[model samples]
Target: MTEDNIAKHGKKGTFQISCFYVGEALCGIDIGFVQEINKQVLLTSVPHSPDYVVGIMNLRGKIVTIIDLGKKLGIESTANITDDTRIIIVNSKQEFIGFLVNKVTDVVVADRENVSPAPSNIKGVKGKFFQGVYKYKNKLVAILDVEEVLENE
Candidate 1:
């Protein structure tokens, strides 16, 4: 084997990313950064923030900025709840926030050798919110940047 090929494919890094479904897309989040997943809860709307900012919710007396991940991911928002929808509470930069997701999949270990970089061209800003792409089983899964998504929105 050539030196170049060895340098390119010789090493890999892995992380346990929690995968979830936001609308029709399957995505992932770094497990270490996530705190907990809260089921259906009450949310308070923030005045004049952004469309993606769903509202705020109280978690054990602590306030959390709730974000509609679908909207943040560039999909339409729905007020109604589905059996699949869930709230993922995360701590980013010491700030707490929650994201509404379609469904929670599983925690899988993804490696650098398996995860391809996020596509350069995209219609919206979600590309910057993704860490990389890895295929689990046979389907492509996007590892999301929780801090970037919440901070940007």
Candidate 2:
């Protein structure tokens, strides 16, 4: 833990988070869960797939399913693809998947103590998809539960 975070949150054992934007809401996930971040990638649509599933893409020799995280969380669909848009690949339960976001923001270390239970609804997303909420730089970053997010798929 850095002296700054230690003094700020007054806790030990700080962990890093990969921050991103989903609509106007700021979100994050444990950096350890992230496999890679792609600026943009070509997608092949899946027929009769879940609404959240954007499509599928080939990463090297592997096929990765892409998800529109905003829609999945009920925030908002990623309307336009811009330079800021990013696809964050994560490995969960030995499966690799990608989460499409409005943008890739920053990476920061946060104290576990700073994480509080998620509200009933945040930016239209159900609290069940989040592990907790952490305050970062006077802003709230909802920490996403990758397992929960990918479950029942």
Which digits, one per residue and each the tens of the lDDT, describe model 2 over residues 46-143?
99999989899999888999999988888788746888888999998788899999999899898786678778788888988987788989999998
lDDT of 1 by residue, 48-150 (tens): 9888787898887899988888888786563446876788888888888888887888999876666777775333435777766778999888878676687
TM-score of each: 0.83, 0.89
Candidate 1 global Cα RMSD: 4.9
Q: In angstroms, how far off is 105's CA in candidate 1? A: 1.1
Top candidate by lDDT: 2
Model 2 pairs in collision = none
- RMSD (Cα, Å) for all candidates, in order, is 4.9, 5.1
* Residue pairs with backbone atoms closer than 3 Å in model 1 (clashes): none
Task: Say which candidate scores most in TM-score.
Answer: 2
For model 2, give the 10-residue run with minimal summed lDDT.
Answer: 1-10
